[model samples]
Target: MALWIEAESVERRSNATEDDLQAIIRAVYRQVLGNAHVLDSQRLTNVESQFRNGDITVRNFVRAVAQSDLYRSRCFETSSPYRFIELNFKHLLGRAPQDQAEIAEHVQIYHQYGYEAEINSYIDSDEYIRSFGEHLVPSARGNRTQSGIKNVSFNRSFTLMRGFAANDVGKSAKLISDIGGNLPTKIVAPSGASGVYSNTGKRFRVAVSQVSYGPRVTQSVTTFEVGYSQLSQKIQNIQKTGGKILRVTEVA
Candidate 1:
């Protein structure tokens, strides 16, 4: 994060010297005090020490020192008395002030005061969530042939899905589409050899539809409707073949 302050002008005062600095300080003091002004030599000395220590520049220090209530009466007598002395310097000069390190330091100070909200607004613009799939049924066979059984249910299964921020929709969709075909598969039902069924001739085959992607919906969408339709069709076919659909007592 970065911060900055804009002073009106600077180049016109390029030749400013120590005398100019003293004049500005005196002006600030006079502005604060009126007819019975008393100069505080001790405080002035401390200000000079701060400047020598590089804690404050001559320009900034003079203004801050002048802002005391004593000086305010003389310098800024109006209701909208300008407390910012930097602006005054800019007005006296012609162009904006130049201080690279000062700007950087000011920016750092602003960040210290917790201005990260502004920083993040310019950086992150998306959010996302992860999803997992589950198995619905296990493989099994009936004693008598049925008309509508096609696929076997599995003991366990899983799938993956993504929920993306609105701004990330384009990229998210592309990525989902690219890896959609390679997603992990769940065994709805195991082969008869796995002891899922006793009859070797009663093995079931698994099939998956193309991965579907779309904006989130409040209720079920056309995709789910279509999937249900296909499942119903398969059930009908298995029932016609004399295979019975197994009914479970409870769902895990």
Candidate 2:
């Protein structure tokens, strides 16, 4: 399976030409918009003009694109909260959420601070600065090794990325069940076939850190082994009962 799409990094040069500026603009749209083709009507004319005139750096241009109404309409408004945040990590940070904490953090930011703040959290992050700096555009980094990232995130990134040919308009959060339950993401081939990634016949162990029984709150941890078909319902039940999920692992 091809885990990563190979693309040359497009960076801004000190003495940039007309062609250079165009390429940078295209790269910005391609990376920030999840490979979606930008229509002339959909283009952020003012932001593009600012970038063309060297008024804003690539980082700011990316910020502008992410926070644009077009992006909000396509990615945020139409997508579930989880799917929106997943795309943010893929498009801006060039990776998937490391764990549930990362996902919860972004979720909290979006709920408490608003959309622009959620986008800014990633663009202003140290990880973003270290990864792409100010001139280079953000792209999928699952192909390369990243410091402090877990091995499972590589598979999760591919799950979100799909490919360079694919756009970010997907509605469902692919890794939501796995990440929310702390399961390792399986890498499936992009052919959309049922194979190793299918959990049809698997069994999983769900660990809940806390669960409320009746009107009483119990802090004791509980574990439940369930089949794949029952996993979703079980997780839902856990959540409904005010349970904190610690992990969900496949049991052999």
Clashes of each: 34, 0
Model 1 CA lDDT for position 122: 15
TM-score of each: 0.20, 0.82
Model 1 global lDDT (CA atoms, 0 to 1): 0.27
lDDT per residue, candidate 1, 1-252, as tens digits?
Answer: 111112111111345466655554444333222213455642466675564455665344434444445334433343111111212211122111122232234335435643333222211212100000010000111111323321210110011111010111010111111112222223233334432311112222223333234684232211211221133344334434444333201111
Query: Model 1 off-target regions past 4 Å?
Result: 1-12, 34-36, 40-42, 49-59, 66-252
The number of the candidate with the highest TM-score is 2
The sequence of per-residue lDDT tens digits that candidate 2 reaches over residues 1-252 is 554675678899899998999999999989888888889999988989999999999999999999999889888998878779899998898888988789879989999999999999999999999999999998888767888788888888887776676677556566767887877887756455422234556788998988446787567888899886666667767876778888888798
Root mean square deviation (Cα) for candidate 2: 4.2
For each candidate in the order shown, give its overall lDDT on alpha carbons: 0.27, 0.83
Q: State candidate 1's TM-score.
A: 0.20
Q: What is the lDDT of residue 210 in candidate 1?
A: 31
